[model samples]
Target: MTTTRAHGEAARDDGRSAGRPSGRMLASYAAGSVGTGAFSTLPGLVLAYYLTDSIGVAAAVATVLVLVPKVIDVLAYPLIGALSDRASHRTGYRTG
Candidate 1:
């Protein structure tokens, strides 16, 4: 089968123009994933380890410290998503 892309271009399910990302784009995406993963994971691991092991804080206290921000995020995300959706609806484009 075929699909019509923008500008009246015909797209097909064949491997040639099936919208698969180029190798360079895939490599860039992989690098981005690794960087993003390290940035997101390392801080939490280091912070928890530092708080408990180096600073001699209690485990429960360290857990709470880490969790409190996530609790706020859990609550805030829905509100933020709703606000962005509303803003987009009103303006016909995303606010940011």
Candidate 2:
């Protein structure tokens, strides 16, 4: 059960090559996730607060206004990505 290693990849007794990410990658990924989470979250929070405080919109109404599009996006994006991938495969263009 020997595994071939890619060039410049360090081999390990654990059977994973350096091509597999290590702790640095995990830290980088964690940082990126935190940044993405904050990036995605702040706009909705600000919009909702603005609607309630500045626009005189009711809090419940503002909450729903802010929430529904996110709900729709959550529901629709997977189907859209699947369709996009299917179209790209049919056209034989991986990057499309």
Candidate 3:
């Protein structure tokens, strides 16, 4: 007799339950999200405050200074990733 497995049966062969992350994994993910949130938000807030209150920059100018880099980052990171991928392909990094 022969049998065929369905969608998630392969996962059980490795002792994992399909479609469900573990409690510890969930907690870790939550912590990572909190850390990522702080890192992404605090710098902008701190920079704007520093530029306006400490350095006496106008609010509008401070806003622009804080935001322009973020805009550049949003556009540049994907382009950089594409370039890195192309370079890696040319270099044959993992084609052994």
Q: How many backbone clashes does candidate 3 have?
A: 0
What is the lDDT, from 0 to 100, of the residue 43 in candidate 3? 91
What's the true lDDT of residue 92 in model 3? Answer: 80
Measured by lDDT, the strongest candidate is 2
| Superposition error at 15 for model 2 (Å) | 7.4
> What TM-score against the true fold does each predicted structure earn?
0.59, 0.58, 0.54
Q: How does residue 15 of candidate 2 score in lDDT?
A: 49
Each model's lDDT comes to 0.83, 0.84, 0.82
Q: Candidate 2 lDDT, tens digit per residue, 1-96?
A: 544577856545664564576777779989999999899989999999899999999999998999999999999989999999889877886521
lDDT by residue (1-96, candidate 1, tens digit) is 788898999877545544456677779989999998799768987899999999999999999998888788889989999998888877886322
Cα distance off (Å), candidate 2, residue 42: 0.8
RMSD, every candidate, angstroms: 6.0, 5.7, 7.2
- In candidate 2 the C-alpha lDDT for residue 65 amounts to 96
Residue 86 shift from truth in candidate 2, angstroms: 1.2
Ranking of candidates on TM-score, top first: 1, 2, 3
